[model samples]
Target: MNHNLLLDSIAKHIHLDEEETALFLSFIQPKKVRKKQYLLLEGEVNRFGMFVTSGCLRSYNLDENGFQYIQQFAPEGWWMGDMYSLITQEPGHLYIDALFDSELLLISKTNLERLYKEVPKFNYYFRILAEKSLVSYQTRAMENLRLTAKERYEKFCLRYPTLVDCLSQKQVAAYIGVTPEFLSKMLHSEPELKP
Candidate 1:
């Protein structure tokens, strides 16, 4: 399997020597997931952190009425996991699934801890990633509270430009926190807003 993408992502944050790179590679377990396949389900403890090598994955939760609310999308070159469950080893509330047939590199919690001790620099890399994730979540939360559905859709389009045309309208509606019909009306009313 091609590891170049993952290695390149790591290189951006930490310079790993040949031996170090090999060690890191040794910790990864490759996985392939078909579209709509569940990588994780509600109440399951997440044992691995996944790095998307190809295609897309999404994490979402369903409400009592069975409406889905998407939390995040991990496209190629992105990392994803239920941080709460991964760190605490407790059940997670979200469900994670492949949005398209995908390839991933998974590092189990045990291996991740070993890497932190063995390479130490990985601590810095993960800290940066966590900080950025936190910032993005905070920004999205604030926007949800303040922005209109149309504005949120615009932001979603900007954030996941690659997904705009590829995702189903229902999926887009879920992410933007609007009903499909509402999104449809908004798009039709504002022709320029169509992604």
Candidate 2:
């Protein structure tokens, strides 16, 4: 499997030697997922952290009324997983699925721990990743409570500029916490939101 992207990601935080890189790569397994395929479902324990090589994936939770509230979108070059379940090894509340046919490199929790031991620098890399993920989640939570729907839409656009043209209006609405009709209306009323 091609791992240039994954290696580049790792290189951003740590310098891995050839041996270290090979050992790290040996621990990960590559998998292909079809569009709309579920990588993880609610009530199932999440065992792997996935790095997207191509396409996109989304994680969402279902409310009591069965409405979906999207938590995140992992496009190419990003990492994603059910963090709570991966850490605690318990059933997760989120459902993770591919938005397009995708390739991923998956590292299981067991193997990840082994990686940390084998390549201690990975601990620092993962710590940085966890901190960034936590901050993003916290910021989104605050934005949901404090920002207007239009402002939230703007934030979504700013955050995922590459995604705007490719994603469906319904998916965009889900991320910005609005109904698809509401999003369409807002876009129509404010031409500036078209971007």
Candidate 3:
């Protein structure tokens, strides 16, 4: 993965001087994970906020019944982390794994704090990010309560068209809160949306 991708991503959100950018890059530790490999597991502290440079990852939790509920999928240029665990330094409920062989840039909580102190603009950027994340979480929760399964599937497609093909139908169904068979029926009924 090109370092420029990380540089470009930061530049899009906030202006960074050369020195600031260098400092930012210095703290980044690049990691590669093969498909089905975990970057983090349940009961582990989420030490790093990860940026996907290539491929995809999913953050999910398994219920008592062993059913997986996916909270988020991070594709190229996206960030993924357990905010609660990162903030509290406690074990997280989610398991984060690569869906495909992936390259990532990780910034540990300690390094992130250092960055926030050294480059105060970074605090503003992260605050904006947190606000957007909260909005998305609230919207998802509302949709789960208010929308029908078919409606949720449609909205999921509209919002994450790339992921529709990138992920398995089963994974998509899990994310949208429906059984695979039900999602199949819904997709079949809407032939235009079926892949």
Candidate No. with top lDDT: 1
- Count of backbone collisions within predicted model 3: 0
lDDT per residue as tens, model 3, 31-87 = 999999998899999999999999999999899998899999999989999888999
Instruction: Please give the lDDT score for candidate 3.
Output: 0.91
For TM-score, candidate 1 versus 3, the one ahead is 1
Per-residue accuracy of model 1 over 5-112 as CA lDDT, tens digit each: 999998899999999999999999999999999999999999999999999999999999999999988999999999999999999999999999999999999999
* Candidate 2: residue pairs that collide: none
All models, RMSD in angstroms = 0.8, 0.9, 1.2
TM-score between candidate 3 and the true structure: 0.96
Candidates 2 and 3 compared by TM-score, better number: 2
Judging by TM-score against the true structure, name the best candidate.
1
Model 2 Cα displacement at 16 (Å)? 1.1
lDDT of 2: 0.93
